[model samples]
Target: MGSGIPVWSDLTISDGLKYISGSYKIAMVYSGDSAPMLVLENKHSYSWDICISASEVSSGVAFYSYDDIAQAFSNYGVS
Candidate 1:
């Protein structure tokens, strides 16, 4: 992560959603699964590839939380 980049893990859900809506990619991954079921891109550029892991929280269906997704972007320098 770059020093100038905003820390995604610190953003609130409301703020995170607003930011990603402008330009970002979203993928829904099942809990414990290794693949994303749906990939959503909103004016986002695929300048680089990113992989996000499952939340690992036991649930009937697992999905990446907003903060988790944001952190992945931050970790990979998506911005």
Candidate 2:
């Protein structure tokens, strides 16, 4: 993995409804297993990809926590 999670990667999140405010992202990934799935990966963390439940999220989409997304990225590029 790299120093930390890259800002380019996508984190999938679903609510079984429309896209949440900040609870998800839009991305593309390959499918596997006996079913279909999304691909959420951070360039920094190439060692492994985070497989999230997509019962609500649309495939190839990245999702973030609507509650903490803004706070989480408060200092993303403040430097």
* TM-score for all models, in order of appearance: 0.38, 0.27
* Worst 10-residue lDDT window, candidate 2: 70-79
**Candidate 1 per-residue C-alpha lDDT over 1-79 given as tens digits, one digit per residue, 9 for 90 to 100:** 2122142322123334565542433433244434433232333564655556545434433445556677777777665
- Model 1 backbone overlap count: 1
Could you give candidate 2's per-residue lDDT for residues 1-79 as a string of tens digits? Answer: 1123344564444542355355454333434432234333445556554443334334543333434333333434210
Error of 2 at 20 (Å): 8.3
Report how far off residue 57 is in candidate 1 (Å). Answer: 4.3
